[model samples]
Target: VEHKVLAGPFARAFPDAEFYATDRQYSFPLNLPDSFLGLPPWTRPLPESGAASDGSWGGEFDHEVLTVKPGPGSMYQDAAFFHGPSGTLLICDALFAATEEPPPILTEEPEYLRALLFHARDTPQEIVEDTPEARRRGWRRIVLLFNFFFPTSAAVADLGVGPLLNLRPYELGWGGWMPFRWKSREAEEEAFNKYSAGGSPTMLPIIQIILSRGGSGEDTLRWVEKVKRWSFKRIVPAHLDAPLAMGPEEFAETFAFIKKGRNEVRFCDQDVAFLRAAEEGPLSFSVYKSSLGVLRGQPCGP
Candidate 1:
């Protein structure tokens, strides 16, 4: 374990809080406390696949925390997965979310945190009286409730089978949830069809980054297949405002964009292939070079 940029603030904010890391390799400019290693609540490195049993986590966290290192290797070489108590399967940078919604804020921030709950789909409140005390109490209760239910402290997510991706602590205030600002509904729909099957264009870059690492087109498919086994009912990606709640039988449809991009890799321009090949090292010279290409603007060919 190593110290992150937020280590100081984190330590200052929660003096008693403990830290944890996955089995994957980690390093930083600063040294991390040894207590984080193999400690209680931290648990051991999670299994590479399958539903992690309750006892596996020592029951310290109340819910299962399954770890899924992307196939071939971890994403960004520093990614980790966890099955949150809310039934949400969390991913680090392996995936992202995007949509055409405005930043969910009420006026300037400070009020944003409290304002967000007023609009949240799952906000437990029904009648919020119009009063300073009522508003303050309501906001406090929501925050406390979310601390346990959604747990944004690590990464905010709802009680569903969804994932959120990398959001700098800074951008968290700027509404990191809405990653993409669509220029138009038509353009948005077009990109949606090509990138995320009208669900999340954020998956495009993730797939590209994966392919740049010599990722097999099947990575998303395989991961999705395994996720299906977990019987997750919803998807709350960190980037997108909309939670993906597809039918169990039609869940695979949500990832159609990734599958399409994977299949279309072979059709990518020669230059893009060469670039990816150069980045992926010499592992599969011809395979990766020829099979993994950019999806944003496909080249017709040389």
Candidate 2:
């Protein structure tokens, strides 16, 4: 995770600050243990219970734990805190949002620029001029690919099957690699438009897949209801554009696709074709209801 550079400094600077994490974070079932992932020795695990309220910070924060029914590819959970004074709902990754502007952090680096231009080109044979607009084009593609994993606008180009003349030159540093190709500029723009959705917040596309399958969505819905009870006017997720000027109603709307009788998906079906394929194949994430009517993700078999 390469978190030591940032996490080590922070942990040292404010050694007394309360540190909280879920138990699974330390003993992650699918990923590396916390010791290697960068958790300091002083860290403490948050309560395993779904909801844990702390009257600390002058009783201004309402901390709630949210968990999805675990599946083979499961292990999704987050702690949301409702700040009473600011009326802000703070979260880690339950929801996500990204503006069109290229994040300033990656703008000046040479490697980032090269990566951006990689997505800007139609194919290896075509040369794209390095420019501000070209860099912006690369960032847009990156955002789509990062969120959807393999948004509909791009597809892998099979170098093994293509003729030598069509292949890119070795001097380009990608002569033998299986690079992806864009379906069309229009397709890329269309997929991005759906993702932006007029700058509205949306849940992870994976959650949409679970709910679409056997997942009843009851567990997540209940968590949403719990969060809505707090008096928050703005929601701030850990990633992307923060402090969204939205209220409880707007925040609740993000999970609309998961509700029963809903036919629509969290994101466009075509846009998330790659995620869908991976879920059914290598990912194989699924959910079901238990005998007690509790919905959980189906665990992966050994």
Q: Which candidate is the best by TM-score?
A: 2
* lDDT per residue as tens, model 2, 171-254: 334662434577766666666666767667876665565544444366767777888888888888877677788887887887
TM-scores for all predictions:
0.43, 0.74
lDDT of each: 0.38, 0.63
The list of candidate 2 runs beyond 4 A from truth reads 1-13, 26-29, 48-54, 104-132, 157-178, 210-216, 285-302
Write candidate 1's Cα lDDT for 1-302 as tens digits: 33234444554565465444444533332223434432343334444543443354444222222232333324223232334454444444434444333234422465664454343322232334444443333333333222122212211334342213423343224333322222333322332333333334234343444443344435555655655554455555444343555333454554565555543432223213433443456533323332444333343311
TM accuracy, model 1: 0.43
What pairs collide in candidate 1? Answer: 162-235, 162-236, 163-237, 164-238
